[model samples]
Structure formats: C-alpha cells, structure tokens
Target: MTFQNEEMRYEQLFRVTAKFHSTMDIDAVLEEVIHTLQDVYPSFSYTLFLAHDNTNHNVIPIKEIQHNVNGENPAVMQAFVTGFVQIEDRIAEKQSVLYAPLKGRQGIYGVLQINAHNAIIFPKSEIQFIELLANTAGNAFENAQLYQQSKQLIADLQLINDTSHRLNSNLRLTETMTFMSSQIKNSFGAMEVGFFMYSKDSLEVLLGSTPFFENGEGEEFVTFSLRKILKEKEPLFISDLHSDATFQNAIYRSMMSVPMVQGNEIIGVAIVLHESPYYFSFDKFKLLQSLIHHSSLAISNSILREELEKLVITDYLTKLYSRNHLEDMVQLSMETDAYGTFILVDIDDFKGINDTYGHQVGDEAIVQIANLIKDNIRDDDIGARWGGEELAIYLPRVDMQTGYAIAERLVERVATYSNPKITISCGIATWNKENKETFQSLFHRADNALYRAKQSGKNQVIASENRVC
Candidate 1:
C-alpha cells in the first residue's frame, strides 16, 4: 500500500471513532460501523452478531449471537469467548473469513465477521484495522446499553414511588390491588395478574385477581406457586412453565411469582403471567420483587384497618351489630327507604334462666336468639344486640306483614333450635314516606309494642296498634 493511501485510511478510522464516541444510540453506532467498513473495503462482506437483540436497523446485516445454532460458527464463538481475532482460511473456496471480537473494557459485546472473497489470507495491517474498528464499536455499544439501563432504572423508581404513595393513601385493599394489577398489565405486558392472600393454612384469591383465577381455571398454577413460595419464601421467575414436568400442558409459558413479605413471613403471593416464552426479563422480575416488597406493608395496614372497623360495630359475645350501629342503619334506612320494619326481640324468662342455670346459660340463650334472627333475615337486614336479653332487627324496604312473619319465624326457631330450649317475644313496627316518622319515633313504637306483647303473652309476635296485625 502507498503511504498516501495508508494515511487516508487512518484519517477515515479517526473520523469514524470520533463519530462513535459522540452518539450513545446503539443502532446508529452499529449502522455507522457497517457503513464505514463498506466504504473502506467494498469488495469484502461484513456482518455483526450482537449479544443483545435490541437493535432495529433493517438495512444493516445484524444478527443476535445468542440465537446462533450450535456448530454453525466455531471461529465466531472462539473470538467472542477469547476476546481476540480469529482467522479461517477456506482454501477449497479460495476465501478468507476473519472474526474480530467487539471487546469493551467491561466485556465483549459481539463478533464482527469479514469475508474476503478470493483472498487466501488477510494481511496483518488489514486485521489490525478491523480489530480497532470492532473495539470502538464495542465501547460505544456498552455506553449505549448503560445509558438506556439508567433511564429505565429511573422510570422504575418513579413507578414504585407513585405506587407506594397511592397505596399508602388509605385506599381499601381491593382498590390497592386493582391499581397494582393495572400497573403491572400496562408496564410489563402481563396477560393475567393475581393477588393471593394467605389465610390460615390456605390461600384465598383476593378481590383484584383476574377471573381466570377466581373461576378455578388457574388452580393448578396457584397450587404450584403456593407450594413453592411457602417452602422457599422467595420470588420465582419462570421462562417456560411447559418445561416443568407438572406443567407440560400449561398455556402460560412465562410467569413471575413474588412473595408479598412482611417481616419474616410471607403474607401473600403476587403472580404475573404471559403466554409467550421468555416474555419477562430478569430485570422485570427484580422490579416486581421490589414493588411487592414496598406494597405489602400498606396492604397489611389496610386489612387491619378494615378488621378494626368491623370490630367497632360488633358485639363481642353474640357477634351481632352493636346498638349504636343498629341506630345508624335505622336512621339511614328511614331517609332512603320507602318503607321499612323494625322488630325488637326479648328472650322470654331470661332473668329466670339466669337465676336457675347461671348467667352463662342466659348469655347462651341470647346468642341462640341472635343466630336465629340472622338465619331468618335477608342479608340486607341489620341484626343487633340491643342490650342484655334484648336484640333487634331492622329490615329496610320491608313492609309490616313481612316483618311480622320474620318475627314469628324467629320466635318458633328459637323455641326449637335453642339448646336448653328458650322462647322469644317480638314487637314489629312499620314506617313509610307518608308517615314522616323519625328513627326515634320508630324505635318508641317498636318498644311500646314489645311491652304489649309481654303483657299479652311471651313467645308471641305483636305489631304497633296503628298497623294491622
């Protein structure tokens, strides 16, 4: 080669290296490498095999090295593994193939193959130039990869921050899980997301899980995940569920199962699934672990808050609503309902039972009556422990006749179902929009009717005199 020609080649290499250093876009860097080589050596063909499959330059001959079939290119593998250049002289084909490792300071990123048609051997100077170009491309690729990864890390942190803030805003458990499911579906492209809470020794599918789990279609996955999580107490990242012997026919190929941990215990498991194999990357699995770790405490707090609220309005012994809660329901019903009925029930001869059998037996009698009231009433009906030996039921939108019938049924059920058999007296009252009755007036009428029933006979149902029955 002439001195002028070598100097010109050096100038081109210098300019391309400067261009590579200026831009952090990986595809642009890769394209520039191929274009520079084509300009310098038009007779030779070039192909770049990258370790990561993120580039989208259709015009450039770029392939992922990881996807290469075994035994296809032993020289390319050796160059990547040894971080050195390799040469293969195809004497029969009268061609020389060169493999140059894209070696960065951190690691090798890819292999660049140069095919010299009709050349038996590549000169040392030509190999040196190609090696320099490959090294420059490798450094640029690493820098671009690191830049993209940093941006992704920032986005992931923002997502976790937003989710943690929203979850801690005292949202209900159902709402929190729903928000999380939506976030996972949008960010990770998950097909199904499920939150399964541990209750006692069993797993209970929570409200925000997809219908696929709630309807029993995903029971096998749930059981498998539960068993693994319970034993390992660690997150699972599965590339192909079908690869496992137990899940050979599984429809979902990719899965991530993270334990919702609080302290040392795993309270629940969060599962995300996809139908395509290897859909979720390891980075995504790590991000999910972080998300669930931060959200678990908030979930636990929400659950505890709901349970505490329930306890506030419940009677301890009978497990019925307290008198205050009954009053609130009655007040709300009177405002919204067209008409409603209130029944006040008292255990017959409760003082006699206490005197004869002890207060424990009397308390048991009150609980028995409370259970009977619950069994006979609709779910919307409010059953409360009014006081010692007295209980109440408020049936919203129910008329006088229906209320009387319910009371009569309770009277009979208590007599028959109560152990150490007992009877109950009931007084029923009805109110409608036309009557303009306040909650206080409604309760007074029910109390007055109860007095009348006690006077008439115990274990009988009576209604306010103004009402028919």
Candidate 2:
C-alpha cells in the first residue's frame, strides 16, 4: 500500500467516523454506515439486518428489507452466527460477497452485508476500517434498543397499574371478567377474547369479542383448549391450530391460553385467539402473563365476596333463606306483586324427635322438609328457615286457595318422605293489595294460625280463615 493511498484512507476513515457519530438514531446511523461503505466501494451494494431481541440466542430479523434484496442471505446469517466476517468467493460467478458481523461490546448486534458487482480485492487496512465502522454502528443499535425497551417497560407498568385499580374496584365477578376481556382485546387488537372460570362442576367461558369464525365448532375448540390446559397445568400457544392434527378442522390459526394462577392453584384461564398465524409477539405474551397474574387475585376475592354474601343471606345447615332474607324478600314481593301467600310450617313434635334420635337426625328431618319445599314451589316463591324447627315459604301472586293447597301438599310430602315418619303443621296466610299488609302484620297472622294448628293437633294445615280441615 502507498503512503498516498494510506493517507487518503486515513482521511476517509476520520470522515466516516465523525459522520457516523453525528446521530444516536440507529436507522440514521445504519444509513450513514452503508453510505460510507458505498463511498469506499461504489460498485458494491450494502445491506443491514438486526435481531428483534438481543437477549434471544437465535437471531431472527425483525425487519425484512436488506438493500435491494428482500430476504436474508445465508452468508449474512452465517456471519452473524459465527460473529466474524465471511468472505465467500464465487469464481464462476465472478463476484464475492462479504458478510461482516456487527460486533458490539456485549455480542454481535447484527450483520453488515456487502455484495460486490465484480471480483474485488479488499486490502487488510480497508477490511479493518469496515470492521471498525460495523462495530460503531452495532453499539449505536444496542443503545437505541435499550432505550426502546425502557420506554416499553414504563408503558407496560402503567397499563398494569391502571388495570389493577379498575378491576379491584368492587365490581361483580362477571362484570370484572367482561372488563378485563375487553381491555386485552382492544389493547392487543385480538380477534377473540374469552375469560373462563374453572371448577370441578362448572366450566364457564365469557366471551368479549366474537371471532371471525364462531359457531358450535368454535365452542368445541374452546372446550378442548380449556381441558388441555387444565390437564397439562401449563400455558398453551398454537401459532397454527388449523394445520395441527388436533385442531385441523378449527377455523382459528393462532391461540393463546394462560391460566389464572394464584399461588399453586389455577383459579381460571384467559384466552386470546387470532385468525392469522404468528399473530402475537413475545412482548404481548409477557404482558398477558402479567395481566392474568394480577387479575387472578382480584377474581378470587370477588368470588369469595359473593360466597360471603350468600352465607349472610342463607341458612348454612338447611340451605334455605335466612329469616332476615325472607323478610327482605317479602317487602320486595309486596311491592312487585299485588298479593301472595305466606306459609309458616313447624315440624310436629320436633323436640321429641331431637330428644329421641339426637340433634343429627333432627337436622336431617329439617333438611328433608326444606328440600321438599324448595322442589315444590315456583321459582318466585321464597322458602326460609324462619327459626329452630320452623320453616316459612312465601309464594307471590298466589291466591288463598292455591296457598292452602301448596301448604297441604308440603305437609303430606314431609310426612311421607321423612326417614323417621315426621309430619308438619302449616299455617297459611294471604296478602291482598287492598289490605296494604305490612310484612310483620302478615307474619303475625301466619304465626297465630301456626300456634292454633299446634294447639288443635300435630299434623295438619290451617288457614287464617280458621277453617281447619
């Protein structure tokens, strides 16, 4: 190499370094690097490709464009994986391709590829300069990537914080699930979103946005996906469900099922599906994992709240409405219905049965009578454990005759079905719109009738009419 050429190369290298250092923007830096390389060799075409995730060992190009060519060249990939400059000589083609790894302080960030139009010799000095330029560009690319990742982290944290606050704000479980599903679908632009509750007896799927194709087949696929995840107890992602033998007939191309894991147990599952293959990114999947992780706690709390409320209003032993709940129901029924029947029933000789067979058998008898009342009444009718050995039933929109018949039938059923041959004495009272009866007044009338029935005989039904049959 001549001193003149060496001095010229020195000037060119200084200019290229200064120009490349002018921008922190990665794309601008790459453009400058490629342009500078072109200035050094005008007959050559240059290309640059970078990895989507620097943490991932496998190098896959996030960007497809490379100079005028469309796809990644094997030589460029080889250079990137090897972390070296690969010189491929093709004498028959009369050209050589140069693939230079963009080496940063940590690792190779990408590859810088050059395709010469004709056979050319790269002096040792010029190759060293090219490598130096590639290294500079690689560092700049990494800096930009780190900056972007930090910004993304901030955004993701804000989203999670906002979502947690919204979800935990005293919403019903179904409402919370709906809100969560909508948030995920809208944020990710997903084709389908489903929130499901998993239990031994019940498997419920709440849909947020309908998919492009949904029918019986879609439902079957959802069930299959849910069962698969529950049995495996792991997250599932299928990029191409249609091609898989397990789901070849399904319409969805991509699916993601993430369990709502709380501690060691899975409380539920969150699912998102798309019509196209490879629709979700790793970042999106991470966000979902975080979303469900946080939401699971909220869901479990909501379910517990509902159960607590049920305990407050229902009798734990008989599974009947408690006295307070029945009174509330009576008030509500009076406001809605013009009239109704309130039947107060007492198990005949309940104390004797407890003394003879023990409290356990007494409880069994009560439960048996409660079940019969529950089974026989209309859904609008309310049955309650009014007090010890006493059960009450409120039938809305029923006349006195209907109320008497219902009470009489219940008396017969309890007597026949009970194990120890227990019988009941029932007091039937009717409420009318014109009477404007308060719940307390109606309850007193029924209670008086019940006392009269007990005074008269054990097993019988008596109406407020004092007509005992």
Candidate 3:
C-alpha cells in the first residue's frame, strides 16, 4: 500500500511511548498500550496481558486485541485471548496459535500471541501484521524499562545528597551520628543504631550486650562506654553485634561503626545497628565514613572547649580560684542558701610595704599570708583572691561566731610569722537568716569589718561584733 491508501497509519504514532517515559506513572503506560491495540484492527476483541514470569524477564503481553468496525460484533472477552511466552527454540510453525518472541538481537524479551474469531482474523497477512506489531512493541518496552531505572537512580542520588547536608549542618557529635543512623534506617529500612568508640587499653570494641566490666548489665554498661570516650582517646565500632549467632540473644542483627579519631588516638565511635540483612549498601558505607570523619572533628573541639573552660575559672598567678569562679560559687550559694562563713582578709599597710621593699616583697607577703591562712582553714573552705592584696574564704557550715574565732587565729598567725613590720587584720560574717542574705551581703559585711579592723589598730582582729583586742 502507498502512503495515500495507508494515510491512517499516521494515527498509529506511539503516544503510549510518551506515557511509559513519565516518572512514577507506570500504570499510565500499561493502560495506554491496551488502549492503542483497541484503536487498531477494530474487528475482534481485546485484553492486555503482561508477563509475571521470569523466563523472558516478564515481557509485557499485548493480547486478545479486538476492534468493532461494524458495531454488530459483540466484543470477545476471554482470559486466554493473547499471551507472550519464552520458548527454548525459535521456530515458525502455526495453524491454531501465533507466537512471536518479544526479541531483539541481544536476547529474547518475551513472546506475543494474537487470537481472533476462528479464521476471520487469522489469514496470512494478519499473521504478518501481528509480527510487525511485536517488533515495534519491543522498542517501546525497552524505553519503559530505561525510564524506570533512571527515575530510581535519581531518587537515590537526591537522598544521599540530603543526608550529607543534614550531617554537615550540626557539629554536635551524638546528634550528627544519630541523624545519619535515622537516614540509613529510613532509606534502607534497617533496625537499631548506635555509636561506639575504641580503646587501646581495652583493645576490642564490645558490641550488643556483653558488658566488658561489672555493673554494666543495664545502665552501667552504657555509662562505662560513654565514660571511656570522655576519659580517654580512642576510636572503634562493633558492626553486626546481633548477628553471627553469638549476639542474637541481645537482639542485635547487623551494625556499622565509625570512629571519631584525632591523629593517632580515637575519641569515640559512631555505630548503626540492624536486626536484618543488607542494612547497608556502598552508599551507606560512604555516608558513614564521611559522617565519622566529621564526628572526629566536632568531638575534638568539644574536648578542647572543656579544657579551656577549666582554665577560664582558675587563676594562673596564685593557682587559686579566679574571680569568675568565685562569682559562680557565690551565686550558687545564694540560690541554695548554703550556710557558709565568708572571711575577707586584707594586708594592713600592704601598699606601704610595696613602696618600701618593692613589689617582690609584696608578692612574697601575699603568698605567705595565703599559705598560713589556707593551712589553718578547713579543707572544704574556698579561698580566692578577692582582688590584689585582698583574699576571701568561704567556710561552709560555719556560723559567724566560729568564723570570728578562725579569723582571730589567722590574724595571730600572719602577724607573728612575718619578717617585716606588716601585720594582717581580718573580718568575718555568716549567712544571715533575718536578711535571708545572699553571699553578696555576707561578703559586704565582712569587707566593712575588715576596714574597721584596719582603722582601729592596724594589727588586730576586728570582726562584725565587739572588737576582740
């Protein structure tokens, strides 16, 4: 037939091919394929059968195809109208059923069978037409498969990228690793997740339920593990803690461990747990590696911060409590109503001594005073440099009378032991019940009394009460 006689052939263009290519629209492709067959050869009846067998990779079936050209023919609707099959040998011998292997040169995709009413649609030319349809249909099916593969790959890539972003945004080690665990579980349906760190002393990373030390059956083991991370430097993991039949009782299946390591030492571990197989893929492993590396950096910073925090609260000069530390303690005392005696001691005529013998002697004087008083005070007492020559002490559980007695002893000790003519005067105050006083009031009253002692005789203990000469 020439183009003039076959002018309707233009209508057979593959619109169903377009539907197959659309992402997440697999149903659209199937419906369109059956609909297309109905449009062509309106003589018999139709139904589309897709292969569910793995013989030819389940090549979709285009079958039982019918068309109503005259409208008097009721549509033939039977199950076995058409089918596609995978036969071992390729042959062409047929009088009852027509079979065309859905094939390309590479391999047989499947088969397509065309059935019709008796011999009304089974002529030699109609057989030729069915073969032609199968050939073109092969290309369409391949396109659909390719579309599905591409869509899945794109989704996986997007998920991996999103996991990366979420892990990077936070530097908190625990939170970051936990986030990775959740992502892996959601993406791959893994069960259970945890992080573990290795130790050089302990050597191996214990997984699942066996406690390495005593008191570790429940809370103690978790505490011991995390405490080890805090106390030492090491990295480790125990993947498959529940697998291998050894840890099945613990309910652990599979696991992955990433260590937060710094240089030669390991800080901690990031762990993921599962109770099933295939918990992780190559993508999951790579994600864990990246996550662990980031974890190491963040954990290192946390360690450094803790050290710096300690230093910030300590005085470098006298190795005593810094002003900031003292302030915090006072605030805590204020809030808790912790009863304590606050003694403020000042070197009498310390500036005159500095002017006479120089700052070196002044420094020596302060040191001598600190040693003498600290040695005499209770071990639980808090001694701090209230500023330059002034020193303060917090004696917990001591009342004003007891503080006054201790202050007298300090004044006696400092005055008698000094090489120079310099002497120290002290003042004492306790937590005030009437005022519901904070450390601020106690400190202020002590300061006032110390000044009075200095003014009265410059070498005696003058507490906040009648002067004890």
Best by TM-score: 1
Residue-by-residue lDDT tens digits, candidate 2, 343-455? 99999999999999999999999999999999999887899999999999999899999899999899888878889999999988999989999998998999899999999
lDDT of each: 0.87, 0.79, 0.57
Residue lDDT tens for model 3, 1-469: 1121133433453444454445343444444544555566544343343432222213344432233324322222121123333122222332234455443334334445444434322445545545555555555565555576587577766776776566556435445545655665676565544444456565323233223221233332344345555565433244454444545566544555555677966655655556554446555666566655754665456446655776787666565677667767766766666566777888988889999999998988888887876688777667787789988777777877787788878888887897775688787777744568766667778788888887788767666665556
Clashes in each model (backbone N, CA, C under 3 Å)? 0, 0, 18
- TM-score of each predicted structure versus truth: 0.89, 0.69, 0.43
- Clash pairs for candidate 1: none
Candidate 1 lDDT tens digits, 1-469: 2122567777878988899889888888888888888878878899887788664577888777753436568788888888999999998998999999988889999999999888888888888888888988899889988898999999999999999999999999889889989999988999999988886668888888888887878888888898998888678899999999998888899999998877888888999999999999999999999999999999889889988999999999999999999999988988888999999999888889999999998988888887877788889999999999999999999998888888888888888889998888888899999989998898999999988888887888889864333
User: Which should have the higher lDDT, number 2 or number 3?
Assistant: 2
Supply candidate 3's per-residue lDDT for 366.
Answer: 84
lDDT at 258 for candidate 1?
93
Listed per candidate, the RMSD to the true structure in angstroms reads: 3.1, 6.7, 14.0
Q: Give candidate 1 regions above 4 Å deviation.
A: 1-23, 53-62, 66-71, 465-469
Residue 250 of model 2, lDDT score: 62
Top-lDDT candidate index: 1
